[model samples]
Target: MQIKADSVEEYLANVPEERKEAFAKLRKTIVENLPSGFQECLSYGMVGYVIPKSIYPDGYHCDPSLPLPFMSIASQKNFVALYHSGIYADPDLLKWWQQEYPKHVKTKLDMGKSCVRFKNVKHIPYELIAELCEKMTPEDFINIYETNLQKK
Candidate 1:
């Protein structure tokens, strides 16, 4: 479920009415917690946090024209999703998130390689998300991203 919009505000405006408040809070949590160097923008039709071209001229490995994507939040058809590249790239981070999720939310974790799906907005764990956001800085991401890229 991609909302066609050019900016974060426009993207948020198109989110399903039922998810508006929770989505806003989720966005706010990410913006407030993510490190200072990451810039917020609309990327791949979602609200995204990225290391801008000025910081990482090489851009994304998959698509060098775009900035280095760190994370994204979207309201999908069935649920709201948070996509964190750091979690996908780091096994330790993934394990930590998996272990800590149950401590914050009782529901069984619904997750993908890099996406965390929140089916019930009320159960979204903002505090846990904040901790996840703080775990990596832009420099940390660039190093991890490049290190993994070289391995491939």
Candidate 2:
């Protein structure tokens, strides 16, 4: 099989027209909100935002290759996925998020780990996604992820 594109624009170009509008909005939202050190690229056929190894030379664990990514958004067979890194690292926020976020939320979405899934673009909560990004920072995320890794 062919490898997925590297840029989000290229990834969008490969998707069907019917799915474009929703993904367009989500992509715009993510681009507008992504922090410094984080960038948009396709990973495993999905749009992923992470600290490139060039920037985080030590990685999250001070290792050369380990990553402490912020979030990843993907359009799956049945749903649009929002993969939040803080879901595991920030328990307090996740507890509130689990309760306060809109109902009909889908969890346990595995794309190597967990993701929140939605069937339609409208179902994806742009605000909450924004909050998650704003709340989780690359530096703090690295520390938290490394701590968890040590725990395990």
Candidate 3:
């Protein structure tokens, strides 16, 4: 169900053609709005745009060497998922977004410990998501995602 591949090419191949069209659209949305310093990458078995590991050294998650990721996206067996770590490290932002994101997204965010899942790409507000993505830089994201790691 979940996308699992070693490379971006491999990942895209796993998705059904219908999902591929949707994924391509979503991928373009992310890329068009991507801020400088951050680059398009395939992480966590999906098409994700996160701070390169070179900057954060941990890629997605708080743990530097762990498999955990800060943010990711995937075209799954049943639905599409857009994982955001921005609010994961910033509770205030999380709460704000929890209330604000729905206004545009118009779907219940399938929340996990930190990820958000949606059954279809149409349900997600890629524009709003794109805004949030654009607002933060890789260094900014790394700083936020790793904030708790520095706590005493």
Each prediction's RMSD to truth: 0.6, 3.7, 2.8
Error of 2 at 49 (Å): 0.4
Candidate 3 stretches greater than 4 Å from native: 57-69
Task: Give the per-residue lDDT digits (tens) of candidate 2, residues 68-103.
Answer: 466777767776777877776778768767775744
**Candidate 2 displacement at residue 66 in angstroms:** 6.4
Worst 10 residues of 1 by lDDT: 1-10
Write down the lDDT of every candidate, Cα atoms only: 0.96, 0.68, 0.69
For model 3, name the residue pairs that clash: 60-69, 60-70, 61-69, 61-70
Top lDDT: which candidate number? Answer: 1
In candidate 2, stretches whose alpha carbon ends up further than 4 angstroms from where it belongs are 1-3, 60-67, 103-113
What's the lDDT for residue 121 in model 1? Answer: 100
**Model 2 whole-model lDDT (C-alpha atoms):** 0.68
lDDT of 3: 0.69
Residue 133 displacement in candidate 3 (angstroms):
0.6
